[model samples]
Target: MMLNPAQARARLRKLIRGEERVFLFLDYDGTLVPLAATPGEARPSGPLLDLLARLCTCPGLRVAVVSGRGIADLEKLLPVRGLYLAGVHGLVIRYPDGEEVWREDRAGDAKKRVEELARKLEPLLEGKKGFLLENKSAALALHYRLASPREAVEVVRRICEEARPLLREAGFVLRTGKKVVEFCPARANKGEGVDFLLSGWRGAFPVYLGDDETDEDAFRAVAEKGAGVLVSGRPRETAARYRLAGPGDVALFLAEVLQDRSPDG
Candidate 1:
């Protein structure tokens, strides 16, 4: 059974209340904002931005947005202050201190292989409505959200078959989420992002919240260090110990967290 927001909040607060500081890591799409038919259309709303700004102001609270989107795109979409942003599944990290780190290894042979895959996939997806190919400098996402179920299945199968050899040779991994299949460097994952965000921090309680399969790695990472909250509409097998129905519940939970640190609480 999934824990409701209140139960999840109580448990999380219990686990972290003793810690000197807290590290809050979040996934972008489907977690902060509802998924959209096109990636370009999933923009952060005013309320989410305001909530994030409020969270950042909390004393001893560190916030990081860990996402599969490229760092540049995340910066453009969010434009919030005092928050770390990890993009391209942690291949790129922009710290709150204004320092930026990128896995340049992906820029060498891995990038070549990804480009080769893009050339191969682009031709196949042409003329197919609802099949969008997004080339996020660090990763490639094949979004079939608008494609019919049959088309999506066929395209996914073909890409998996065609890219399998290239990915194997280049040490790349294919990750699936919602209606998208993303090809990224094998070394890049959300777990690494969480590690990067918490590096050098002492005795900090880490909390990870996400709503995608890609988030499982992060769930396991924080489960070892602290906790993971799964945001979903239905129960599923996940490493996350707690759940919130969707982004609405996530907002309410964040509001509660903010309220707890307020003067009245």
Candidate 2:
């Protein structure tokens, strides 16, 4: 059962009411900001940053931007203080206190393999317009959002076929999103990242918001401890306990939270 806007807002308010500790795990693209034709065009509004900063300042509340983007990229884009940044699907986590943690020590080899796969896929998608090969250093994403449906499907099939052997040898896994396919390290996922971020905060509740299939793992992770808000215009098979229409709705929800000055209410 997906929650409507009013119901979802009321439910979220109740979830955080009088809570001593809260953790917010938010996805960047498509959740905080609308999905852009190119990744570079996706940018959060200035007010959004101010709101997030205010949220971070609230007592006993910790906020984290957990996205598939690289840590450096996220740092450059969202310069909010007093927040955590978990990048590369949680492969790397940077704490607000200047501490950092990484999942594996063999990232060098993994990234090389990912680049190799990208190279192999380039020729396969040679003439396809709007086919973007994004290398996040820790993962590779094939974005065909602007391509025609037929071309997207064909590109995906050919990439899957050509990269199978490389993926096998590197023990990598493929994750599908809205018109995008990602090759990531098998051991690192959004779920594991959420767990890592929540470790030792046994009593604290979590609220996760995401908009893509890649976020399903984080949704399931938060489901055990708190709630997951799926930001989509339509209902779909999801582990999220609630749903919002889109980024506009998400901003409104955050604004409500910001207006609630009392943290222990």
Q: In candidate 1, what are the lDDT values of residues 28-133, reduced to their tens digit?
A: 9989888998988998889899889888888878888999998889999887889889998888889877788876555766667778889988888777889888
Q: How many steric overlaps does candidate 2 have?
A: 1
TM-scores of the candidates are 0.94, 0.94
Report the C-alpha displacement of residue 193, candidate 2, in angstroms: 0.5
Each model's lDDT comes to 0.85, 0.87
Q: Candidate 1 regions off by >4 Å?
A: 104-108, 262-265
Best by TM-score: 2
Q: Write the per-residue lDDT of candidate 2 for residues 89-180, one digit (tens) a residue.
A: 99988898868778867888888988888888888877789889999888899888789888778778988888888998998999888778
Q: Which residue pairs of candidate 1 clash? A: none
